[model samples]
Target: MVNVFITGASGFVGSHLTPILLAAGHKITAIARSESAAQKLEDQGITTIRATLEDIDVLAKAAGEADAVIHLGFIHDSRSYAESVEADLAVITAFGTALKGSNKTLITTSAIPVAGVPTPTELSPGKIPPRAASEQLTLSFSSPEHSIRSHVVRLPPTVHGDTDRGFLAHYIGQSRKAGFAGYIGEGENHWPATHVKDAVQVYKLVLENASGSLKGGEVLHASQEAGITLKTIASAVAKRLGIPTKSITKEEAGQTYTFLALFLGIDCVASSELTRRWLGWESVEKGVIEDLEGSGWYFEETSVTKF
Candidate 1:
């Protein structure tokens, strides 16, 4: 069994990923920020490191001893951009310093929206360069820089599934709260997606492939369905909540969802052909629009309480 180290193991993705690796006979060394969270990790037979991802010295020491490192911690607050940058940079530097000369595996999550051209063509590959520049910065250290094995897995906008706490959940919560479901403009903008379990399996595959080497600084997209449009999601949300559905102006969307407004507007159809072809990653995720329309979680949360 390989010994793997993971950052942010108490989060949505990290929580789901833990059992998968453990069941596969891999031992996990996970980071937990709280005492209760650390106890939970221990209960599950995981080695717990009680430190945030930004604690470079602690993280580096932990990472230096592991066979692979999965970076899943991120600060979603855009208001603290500089602080977030500082933290993320520190973690990256720690990883480099800890595994500087080693060819160990390191995987970090990224996204597809902010990487490349607004409308990417078939000719324009989606290796990287989307919403987050962190991919380039992280993978830049591969071989040439620090000789550490590293890669970025760019996730689709909607990581739809039962346990998701991200975009889809927010959409459902707000739609029910507002007594309507809708989108901006023509609602032609696409939201890429993959199931949580499917994405986790992809990470496991990357971990096992020691011979493949992920080519220092590699960026792979975890897109399962590339073109689930926003309008479709709105209609689904409306049906589940028994609410009216329609389109709105961009100004309206901006007002309703201040932080997510810009994100909901980006349309990019990402392809994971490279991951499938190279790493043999196969997606078993149910289609995003189809599943969201049917999930009980949407209707379960009352409009009175915010998500």
Candidate 2:
């Protein structure tokens, strides 16, 4: 079994991923910034390193000690998004330095929206998105000369499951605040989605197959439903919150949705067929619309004001 070092181990996807890895007999060492977070992971028999993403030296040391590294830790602050991206880049660079010429696996998390194309495949080039720099850098470290088996898992817009306080939850919260759930101009823009359960399996498979056919600098999409329209998703949220659905203009969306305005109208349709063929990975969970309409957890009270 591999000794894996993970960032964001207590996060939504990471929380689900950790237990599965442990069950599969892999040892996990997680970085926890808070004592409570550390204690919680420690209680689950995970070794905890008390550090944040900004602790590059600590992160490098931790990366040097592990057989593999899964980077899921990202600061979701829209107000300081550039800073968050910088921190992510720094952490990735540190990991690459520690694992250089080691041929160990390094899986970094990115989003499907990073691809500006109509239908993004694994080979689709990243555009000028917020996290594009980190994605490019991660893939660049996969050269045989570097010997770092780096892979980037581009997660869809909606990684839905219970206890999720992501973009979907933010939409739900916005719906609750406003009388009606709003979408931009006919709301035909689409978003790719996947369940948390299905998304975590991609990470596991990537780690497990690192020494096999899986090569460095490869990009994988964990998207299940390729394209769920914004109108459909908005309507689902409105129905769940017992609110009406409204069509708002782009200007109004900016004013109402604030930082989430751009994402609300973005059309990011991504395909994971290559990833499925490469790793034999199959998505076995409900899609975003299904999960939103069927699950009661999405409308629950939670603080999701930030991105």
Best by TM-score: 2
lDDT by residue (tens digit), candidate 1, 210-239: 457456666777778876788888888888
lDDT of each: 0.75, 0.90
Over 1-307, each residue of candidate 2 has an lDDT whose tens digit, in order, gives 9999999999999999999999999999999989999999999999999998889999999999999999999987544888889889999999999999999999999998887888999998788566899999999899877899999999998899988988888888877888789999999989999999999999999999953768788999999889999999988888888889999998988877777887888887888999998999998888888898898787767555336
Q: Give me candidate 2's TM-score against the actual structure.
A: 0.96
What shift in Å separates residue 224 of candidate 1 from its native position after superposition? 1.0
Model 2, CA-based lDDT: 0.90
RMSD of every prediction? 2.8, 1.4
Evaluate model 1: give its lDDT.
0.75
